[model samples]
Target chain A: MILVADSGSSKCDWVLINNHGEWVDKIKTEGLNPLLLSKKNISNTIDKVQHLLNKKHDSTIDKIYFYGAGCGSSGSGNLIKDLLYTTFNQAKYIRVEEDIIAAVHATTQEPGVICILGTGANCCYFDGRRVIQKTPALGYLLADEGSGNYFGREVIKSYYLKKLPLDLEESFEKEFGADLNLLLQKLHNVDSPNKYLASFATFIFKHRQHPFIENMLHQGIAKFIDSYLLNYKEELLDSPIHFVGSIAYYAQDVIKKSLDERGFIVKSFIKKPVGHLVNNIINKNIL
Target chain B: MILVADSGSSKCDWVLINNHGEWVDKIKTEGLNPLLLSKKNISNTIDKVQHLLNKKHDSTIDKIYFYGAGCGSSGSGNLIKDLLYTTFNQAKYIRVEEDIIAAVHATTQEPGVICILGTGANCCYFDGRRVIQKTPALGYLLADEGSGNYFGREVIKSYYLKKLPLDLEESFEKEFGADLNLLLQKLHNVDSPNKYLASFATFIFKHRQHPFIENMLHQGIAKFIDSYLLNYKEELLDSPIHFVGSIAYYAQDVIKKSLDERGFIVKSFIKKPVGHLVNNIINKNIL
Candidate 1:
């Protein structure tokens, strides 16, 4: 048996494959970003979903593949690898990679720029054989330009700053029951604030057509283009840029306009890449 | 006697005016932003500058007016008020206000927009009698678009991201001795990271001519315009927008271009508002 998992700051999805390369079991769990979660927290999350795990084959699982956020920047994702080993006892071989790899493989193999705008934002250039990045992934605190975390922080912050329109402000309060005190507490106490913040995608989506939201979308997409897309100038127009994430999927209109203005073609937008990534993994015969 | 002080997150300037409105004494102290400092920290900062105080006239001083950063949204600037009272043992009253007040008076008492781009960033509309902000000042983490902190963060972050040009990257490491670990430590352990981050403005100003720096300035200024100046749509060009702080003074060309492209007029760029602010106070007989 082989287990493959894709994790963002908000949630994780797992797919188990049988000996014949057939999908067998699937499980969903809370976010497992090692940088944000403690050892105990990760285990606690896993414990809740362990009953869904194929316990009969847990020891028989020969290989486990994990790709996730915060894995790239934290010195090679050792935390997740170690924790995954404990969870699936007999994983003789386990490979942990940044979530970008899953996104890249799931989207395309051609030369292009691949971007993730889910709970967090990431970008890279795929040159057919390998991946190259114009900049290091600085994680949510310093980066994540056009991501869920980005929009979440902006909306909540703009509300607190009284930058929101009066109608939108009232809607936000009624929608989230969020005040400064609650926001501060959640940010300070929650194990996964990236997830907490990204949750506001709901409110934003509800009012997506609002002038403020549209304008914000424009600015956000512009920043993303500046930081992630502009540096790959040679491939900007030559190769298509692909996006993978819920944010990218829903904000496609604004994304299209921003990219079109700059003459960059977007090839694909995949909301969840786990399924395609699994197909890629099996076709490549890595297991 | 009256003391008028203007403070940013990095430093504070204090001027003493005698009964005849003569500028009797002047002293400079480390920043005393109540929101970012402990009572002890505020005291220690005052202690260092206390020796410079005119002890003979300290008890005779009837009024103290302090304008500083982190003073606004923290509910009445009471911390600085109490601390100053303890230090001066004044005969009467102390009025503490945000640093923007000083910038407002120093640059214009007219209907222009007032912006501070020092260690932190702030903007507001000055209707002559009082300051009206489009949004509340949210400090360095959530706000401070085109200020020292904003530039400092971008420059350092880009360096770590390997997004800087090779020559600039080399200069950064050679000039600052900064690596990921050191940067993280400074951010996590520093007493006043807003000041610490703003320290990088030196490097930025030195390389202001670089294309990378210029582009960054454009983006930062644009963001500032969007958040701070854009909201006052009716006043966009009707009133002049004045700026104060070293960042604004140094980056005037870029600021002007951004504001001008949007049809906003540039009235003044005062590097340190304390000097002119003192004059305004004395003329107005604020005490």
Candidate 2:
């Protein structure tokens, strides 16, 4: 059996397949970014599913392919590889790759830009083979343009700055308290600020029809396009662009409209890229 | 003995005054923002100063006029007042006012737009006597436009986004690590994210002469002016717009130029408002 995983800052999707590419099992665990978590924490996240991973599926796991956020750097990738060695002791082949690579495989087989707008945000230009990102994924603080946390932070600011419409403000207050004390929890003490901030994005989507939300989405998409897509420039126009994340899937209308206005062609948006990634890897015969 | 205090999110300045409006002793303490701090923590901060407050200054403390950040709301003001009473048991009178009032008192007694660019940011229109704020003084997370944390966050982004010059990037890497894990600690587990972020603002100031830093400052100042100063509109042009807090004092040239270009008259900047506030209150006979 071969185990393939695609993880973002919020959640990870794990799937097992036979040598013939037939589905064996599918499982999900909370996000385990090697950079954000300790070796023990990362090990434990996988350990929690040991029963499903090793018990029910009694076959020896020959190979493990892990693609995750925060694994863009070789240091973090090596760290996660080391941690995985301890978990999948039976696996002879273990490969760790950045989440952007998974996004590229899931979205396209041609040269193009791949953008991930999940709990965190990231983008890369694929030269039909390797990923090239001019800007680093600086996490939720310094970057994350049109990602979930990005909109979440903006929505929160709107709520507090009194920029939100009356009804939306009331809804936000009810969902999340109208107090700084509660908001400070996300800023200071929260274990995962990205997930915490991204959780607020739900409020925006729930009220997506509101004029306030629509305008906010348009502005956010425009910003993402300007910041990331524009950087790719001449090469960008030739190849198809694809998105792989919840933010992109849900905000498709706004994103599509904005990109259309700017004359950028968007090929597809894969909400949960795991299936496509698994298929893409299987078809490439990498396993 | 009368005690007058002016505080931002980072530091609090305290001054002792006699009935005849003469300075007795001056003391400084870490910031005690009532909104961010628990009652126990707030009381503990005061308790640490009890020895200096009572033993060194051997006199009955009669009143306390505290002007501080996070005290804009009546609830937090009352909370701080309650905490103050627990510390200064001998005090006969206690008054808790928002920090913007301190800026107004320290800068001008006449009607003007009082802007605070401190550890946090705030602006209020002091109509000769009463302070009028069309918007709430939302704390660091959502607002704090032209403040230390604001500029500091921007500086951190520039560093991570590789937008900073090579020298400044090296300086930033030395001061605050080049790694994301270290940055994650700030976003997740920081006790005071405001101060942590504001610490990066020093890098900007140290390299203020650099074209990049200057440009960043210009853009930041423009954003601040657009977000805050513009809200005051016609009254802002007529009034002698005054500023208080360290950020305002340090960024005066940029601020003045921006405001001047926009034709707004900036009168003065009070770096530490404690002494000025004491004098202003002393003369006003508010005690």
Candidate 3:
């Protein structure tokens, strides 16, 4: 079987394809980021994946492709590969890459722009299987400009500013409480501000119809396009753009509207690129 | 001469009222806050006042009424009073209280809510003489629910989210740049996130007529009132509301419309309560 794993800071989605290019099984395990997770956490996740594999199939995996968070640096990717190689010894070949690469490959291998809109966000202009130009996706603190974290941060600001509708404000306070001192301290002082900010996006998703939120989403997507695509000027103007991430998958209409208004066209929206990546890997016999 | 001084965080506005209860001279000086300004800064501000007095009247001050920022805290206020007392030895009385007190006194202490809407914000229920109840105004990180800081923070979010109009977004980027990494670092890591957030409010002031901004101000004010007053449920049903701040002065119609929609009767809107406080002190002879 050919195994493909897409790991993020929050969770990992896996797909196992048979030798004949037929779908076999799918599995989801806890998040596995080598940078943030401890050895114990990594072991626990591996054990869980093993248990799921045992229940689903009898044969050992022949090859694997891993695309994960914190895999941007070679050191981080090697750390994850070392851990996985030790666990899945039967695997013949193992390759690890940054999640953005997988997203780019899955969306458009031919020169174009690709964007990730999950918990955090990142974008790049892919020039045929290679990232030609990129913008910093400095997580929640620096950027994450067009992602879930951005939406959540805006919602909290609106709540604090009392700019939301009275009923929404009351609801927010009821759900999140009025003690912002504690909330802000927790968000900024805690180790994971990204999670804290991302959690608020659910509140935005819940009230997407609200004018303020709608405007927020529009502005956020516009900013992302402006920052990544518009900066490239003439090179990116005629290129087809595509999105790969949960936020883009769910909010494609909003994204399309924003792009349309800005005189740009969106070619495709794919929820996750793992399936496409797996197919490509098997077709190319690289796994 | 009966010297009357009303100081806020930004600047100090003073009037030298003669025995006839008429203004004989006026002066403006740099802000004097014991917490923010050093003794040297305070002395410099005082020197400016003295220079103004000497340049205009060539007469020494006799009695003084000094109300200012940092005066709400006994320690800070005493420090300020001691400095002013030593400088103007001819003045017999130098009383200091919270700046909001001056706002309340100036607005006719007739049982209503008072708000300060400059760089930061503070709100309190006033009963003629003293503030009966106050929601904690812990700068920007903890609070500052309804002020320029709130407006600026929201605008930044909107710009980052790509929800702002292209022209507006371009202007914002041209003006402030979309380097959210730098912005967030400065906002969160700095000593005063309130000031950092408040700095952005100028963007709103510059584009107050924009629909997005108008909606933001309307929603922001509504949220503030709801948090402070509507949350009281039955007790706030008939209470009159009033505003005293730069924003209240600039956005009176927006504030009034927002409050009216929420079933509130806005009694007054004053730009600065220092004049009213001066009148009150003169009439009551309390100082």
Candidate 4:
């Protein structure tokens, strides 16, 4: 048995596979960023799932591959690796990689720009086997770019600024609230401002028909491309650009329009890259 | 003696105007927005400034006109008034009004649009004597269209998203650290996200020469105009639009461009309305 995991700021997706590459079980746990959690916290979080696997599966666990947002940095990656080692001591092997790498492996087998436009945004120059060149995503605060959080920030800004059209504002007020107090409480006084902000992207998608929102969305997407995707301009013109994230999937039309206008070839835009990632793991015959 | 105050989310500007309408003293203290502070907290905050007046001035405090962000609403205004009355119980007259009214009185003596684009945004149709018609400004979270916090949010979004060009990014990093952790800590874990966010507007003003930043400022100001100024279009065409806020004062070019493009006349723009507010109290020939 093997375990594969991808973790973002909001949640983690986990899959259990048998020796024959057949699905066994899939379980989701709260997001665990090693940088944000203590070693004990990480251990306790994983301990919650220990009983579900049973002794037999736990002992037979062949490998654990975990990819997460903050794990891209060496210090945080090693911290998670150590934490997983303690949690899955029975496993034969353990590997930790950045979520962007998972995105790269999941989306492409040839050289191209691989973009992750989910809760956060990241783009890497994938040369089939690995990321050769990349633009650093400063994180959601400084640069999620075209990610859900990016769009969410815009939505919140527009909503707070009352720039949303009257009809859209009415709908938003009905859905959210008509005041900043609620938003301020949720965003600043609560945990996970990223998730709080990202949640509004759905509202934007729902009201994309509004010229204000459409222009805002276009500007956000255009900004992402200009700041992230456009970094790979030379290679982008030659190879197909691929996106893997919920924001990209739901806003495909907008994304496609952006790409089309920019004259870039989009190979694939997938909502959930886990299936493709799992396929890559099985097809590559990696332990 | 009289004290005229204009308080926003961050700080309070207090000016001592004698019965003769001459300036006597000026004191600034931490912000005292009644909506956010408890009664006890509000009293404690005012207690800090009680001694600043001295025994003579304290005894002679005939009136206090407190104009603050959250004071317009009856409940909050009464709470602050009660708090102040307790603090300066010797005072003969005490009044609490919304900050928007101060902006109106400070800049205009005739019917026109009065805008408060400070940490938040608000506009009112002051029919000389009182607000005959007004647009509801839903605070910073829901509707500070062209305020410092509004522009500040954009600066932060772009800074974190790395949407800032290389040169500006370097400057931003040099001034405010390169990571989002610092920003997140300041904005969430600490207190006052509004102030933390609004603080970035200074950065925007400093780098307004950058094309990216210039465009952002323009967009923000334009949004404010479209949403707030445009609401009173018929009146705006005939009457002068008066702005009172740090954002409007510093980014006067952008604000003027927005107004010019719309064919609206800007009567006056002041960074701090305390001078005008005090002048209004003195020159109005009434309490």
For each prediction, how big is the interface RMSD?
A: 3.6, 3.5, 7.7, 5.3
Question: For residues A176-237, what per-residue lDDT tens digits would candidate 4 score against the true structure?
Answer: 87665545546543345566678988988888778888898888889888887877888887
For each candidate, what is the lDDT? Answer: 0.81, 0.82, 0.72, 0.77
Evaluation by lDDT, superior candidate among 2 and 4: 2
lDDT of 4 at B211: 85
Error of 4 at A220 (Å): 4.3
- Tens digits of per-residue lDDT for model 2 on B200-251? 7887788888898898888888877776777789787678898888888999
Sorting all predicted structures by DockQ, with the top scorer first, yields: 2, 1, 4, 3
Candidate 1, residues A1-287, lDDT tens digits: the string is: 88898998888998888878889888888878776677798878765555567554453778888898868755538877877778767678999888988888888878989999999888999988798877666666567888898888888778866688999999999988854544554554477767787887677888988999888888988988887777788877678999999999999988988888888898899999999899887887643
CAPRI quality of model 2: acceptable
Docking class of 3: incorrect
Give the lDDT of residue B57 in candidate 3.
82
Which is the better candidate, 1 or 2, if ranked by TM-score?
2
**Sequence-dependent TM-score of model 4:** 0.78
TM-score of each: 0.74, 0.83, 0.53, 0.78
List model 2 lDDT by residue over A1-287, tens digit each: 88899989889999999878888999999887876676777888888766567778778888889999988778778888887778788889999988988898898888998998889888889888777887777777556778898898889878766678899989988999887655664464455677888998998789988988988888888877766667777777787789999999999888888888778888999899999998888888644
**TM-score order of candidates, top first:** 2, 4, 1, 3
In model 4, what lDDT does residue B34 have? Answer: 66
> Least accurate stretch of 10 residues (summed lDDT) in model 1 chain A?
A180-189
